[model samples]
Target: MSSELLHDSGLIANPASTATLSDADADSLIAELALRGRAAQRVLAGMGEQVKADALRHAAAALRAAAPRVLAENARDLDKGRANGLAPAMLDRLKLDDARLDSIASALEAVANLPDPVGQVIDQRTVPTGLELSRVRVPIGLIGIIYESRPNVTADAAALCLRSGNAVLLRGGTEAVHSNHAIHAALVAGLEQAGVPADVVQLLPTQDRAAVGGMLRAAGLIDMIVPRGGKGLVARVQADARVPVLAHLDGICHTYVHSAADPVMARSVTLNAKMRRTGICGAMETLLIDASFPEASSVVAGLIDAGCELRGDARAQAIDPRIGKASAEDWDTEYLDSILSVAVVDGPEAALAHIARHSSGHTDAIITGDAAAAERFLTEVDSAIVMVNASTQFADGGEFGLGAEIGIATGRLHARGPVALEGLTTYKWQVRGTGQARA
Candidate 1:
């Protein structure tokens, strides 16, 4: 609650504002948010599972009820995006329709239906010293979510944190600020109606970007920071944050077709993996084809026919004259668009080797009929999510049946892969002993 606490925590008070508010105002804003978030989290942690579930249900209902307003706000964001020359892929992520709005509300209900993670016993044992010890899941209080572009993250992040019993401070990108405000209003309405503190989920009032620095440096206030955005934002958060960060970096995902891959299956899966919503983080950005695989041309043909722009290596260019030349940078790029980078490799080993060099460690898949090759690919590729004979598009939290994900963590520590409600919680050791003293 005090600004002096930052200095006391051995963290320098950062220059959080030179653009919007004065340093004093920025510090005050963060201090107030911290106090409110901590207060709400304490109350939320004591609530029973049913209470939290019911509140989430109420929030879902509120979102559905406020659909007209939410849609209207989304329209404003879309208009601004178009006028501001926002990229088509980014605009798609920001836009929401009737079905999408319903999906957002449905995600809240889905998370509500999930088993509560808090208070669940992770491990229990009795020691030789006659001490009963149990490790139980508990809320990681006051989480800060700093994300970009996707308005759906507002609803999803809020739902996951609330379901896990952690108070959240949401900082969405300025592109969807109006939409975020509308959704936040609906969420708050439901929380207040259900007798939950409105502070349980708070969106920052300013989008000056300096408040993010404030949040990053709020050591004792925010327990952890979950950054969901492009490489730039995630890298900046990781580099600058004084608190712990769960980083969701760029999705430079890959889809490899093994030498034994079925041509028909490869065509279907590769097309879907790359184009099924190119704006999403799970969409495959690179295609690695084993030179021994038959019908590499058709696999590239299917994608091209589907309006995908292909940038290929020399070998891949030989298959299709329409293909563009791929640069050295293409291998490392996360093309969250209709464009796909193509490369032809000699064998399964070469394909695997290519993926190893280019993958962002997010999600990678192998399509093959040979179990040995599939198994080897599955065992070798080091990624957050790996698949055999399946599309990388399936790399989603809801698809994994965790209800909804806060983010797909590229980081290895603590929470990895699709971060759901369980990922939002940590554990504490509870020991029961009587008449035991250290000797």
Candidate 2:
């Protein structure tokens, strides 16, 4: 009933179209979103696995049916991004084509096929006094997701949240707002047809700066916030949120080449990690080579030959002047682009030392044939996901057999890895106690 609602109502005339949802209307919409989420979550939690599967199946169908419209909306975003001078890397992430739309729908189908994470009873036992204690997986209630300019994320996040029996609040970057909303329209249509609450998969109607502030601090409305963007946005949300956050602060990842590393595999994996998708969170930002490795020089040379612009410190720059001189900042940067920083370490100890000093604890990979060295790297890396002879990009949950992920959680406590279905829920202890009085 606010001025904002009138404004938003005007924008909704073209149901298939997307426009900025005003701030004045956002609070009321969010309130409705939270209420609907709570209700939908309750029903979903009680839903038979078959029913949930059916919903996912229908959602996939709806996504496929709406692909053309999704692509059209995405083009609008891409055109706007180009006009606004968005970086190529960012635009790549923002753009969505038919192939990407199909992939997003395929992911939903995959989620429909994965084992349901809900109704999973971890431990159940009866005590001597006839008290039954059971630990069961349950939905996390309501989830709030804030992500950057990836339109597929709109569908992926919503599907993952819904399948896990959690209601989701999605706030994507302003740049992809149009694409995100269009995709959400399909999601809502699927949910409604499946008899699920449209609010269960709500998108923020407004693109206001203050809306994020409000969502971050909506302690009662949101159960937790999942931030899936750059360090600045994640840090800002973390600082502002009263609600707990499942976050991947930064992917300042690395690939360390040991003395025993196979140069060819290391080079190929490193190239793919950095150049295949430079703007993704899992892209390797730093390349570390053992000082003692004879092929280390060749590996660095190979990277430079493969079109990587490497920056290094004095010791590293002395080896190759064609590579730029890396400053202290290079060691700590998450370039998220074509740029990569290089460092030379004496051995595994030095590699671990450097990683410990500079890693953001997102993803780190080691290339080594030696089992002992690989084991040491895996054990000592101290990241949410560690890899051996693989690109850090493999850290994604989908590659790890998770149908999809809300985001990768780099936090050390409770949730430290991929925010998949299991991560979307928490455990509850169901207790039934006999009549036993305290003495």
All candidates' lDDT scores?
A: 0.89, 0.83
What TM-score does candidate 1 reach?
Answer: 0.95
* Candidate 2 segments whose C-alpha is farther than 4 A from its true place: 1-26
Best by lDDT: 1
lDDT of 1 by residue, 52-127 (tens): 8888889999999999999999898899899999999999999999999999999999999999989899999999
Question: In model 2, what lDDT does residue 265 have?
Answer: 87
Worst 10 residues of 2 by lDDT: 11-20
For model 1 the local lDDT of residue 130 reads 88
Per-candidate total of colliding backbone pairs? 0, 3
At residue 96, candidate 1 shows an lDDT of 96
Error of 1 at 253 (Å): 0.9
